[model samples]
Target: MQLPMKTNRITITKITADDLEAYEKLISFPQIAEGAGFNLISNKQMLGELAKRQIANDNTFGIRVHDQLVGAILLYEQIGQCGFPDEANLEISYFLDPELWNQGLMTEALEKLVEVFKQTSEVRTFNAEVFVDNVSSKALLGQVGFQQVSTVIDPLVGRKKLIYKLEL
Candidate 1:
């Protein structure tokens, strides 16, 4: 997947082994976990394992500014809701450095990434699920043309989630 998008002073590239360290640092932040409303990270060893798995398949990417990773984005298929690549509906998720909040970097990166996927991949529908309380994320999704299609609940977080779908 040789797609690296440059937009508004940032580049989004595929996740690699070299990116594990930066990813670990980002995941360790309290704001990252709180903003996303979930935590799949506990310690360095676990993060290393997860990064190794992600690197093996290259389904995700590191969002960078001046070659320093500040975030990541993923566009892949889901099993239960829709289907795989055959459905042409990809689940899109992203997280940025807390310090970069209110900077509009994510909106720029996402707009370009979606544009790239629209042209290069079989993706026709982009799915996004943001926690109800995440007003920033909800605004970003809306800014990128994603419409609220449904409301779902996360049993673990015990909060409502806004499900968005963007048709390209």
Candidate 2:
């Protein structure tokens, strides 16, 4: 909702092409990609295009610490995924640098973003889908007050998808 939101330990800003080089460092890790449920991108050109598309959409935010991009949080309208077909609902997705895992940075960032969204938007519900094996993400959503509502097999990936919801 707002640009450059500040949290207790990190700053959230719109992801820009300028941050792509540093953002690449976070996405380059196979573990991060796997945990975030996205395919790894090795080509800088494709990453550049993704940066442009993300910037134009204005839904993805960069998680920065002392001016360096270390991770990202994406909040966007949810449709036809996690059994949420309504456009009023939003899906929360994120990935953080592996080196910063278990440090509580993502929790803080996610909490602040949701708080801001609650204040700025009319939306009352947020949704998140995580693979059943991603314990950390499931824990993160629970910590932020999201309750798991359902579980379904992902036909594309053939994995159990846990659907989480947070109602503001």
Best by TM-score: 1
Query: What's the TM-score of each model vs. the native?
Result: 0.88, 0.87
Instruction: List model 2 lDDT by residue over 1-168, tens digit each.
Output: 668899878999988778767776676688876666445565668866776676556788999999989998877886756776565677878888888999999999989988887899887888898999888899999999999999999876688899999998
Compose the digit string of candidate 1's lDDT tens values, residues 1-168: 356778868998887878878886776678776655436456668766766775565668788999999998866676654433444777888889999988999999889887887778776889999888889999999999999999988777678898999999
Of the candidates shown, which would achieve the greatest lDDT relative to the real structure?
A: 2
Write down the worst ten-residue block by lDDT for model 1. Answer: 78-87
Clashing pairs in 2: none
TM-score, model 1 to reference: 0.88
Steric collisions counted per model? 0, 0
Model 1: lDDT to the true structure? 0.80
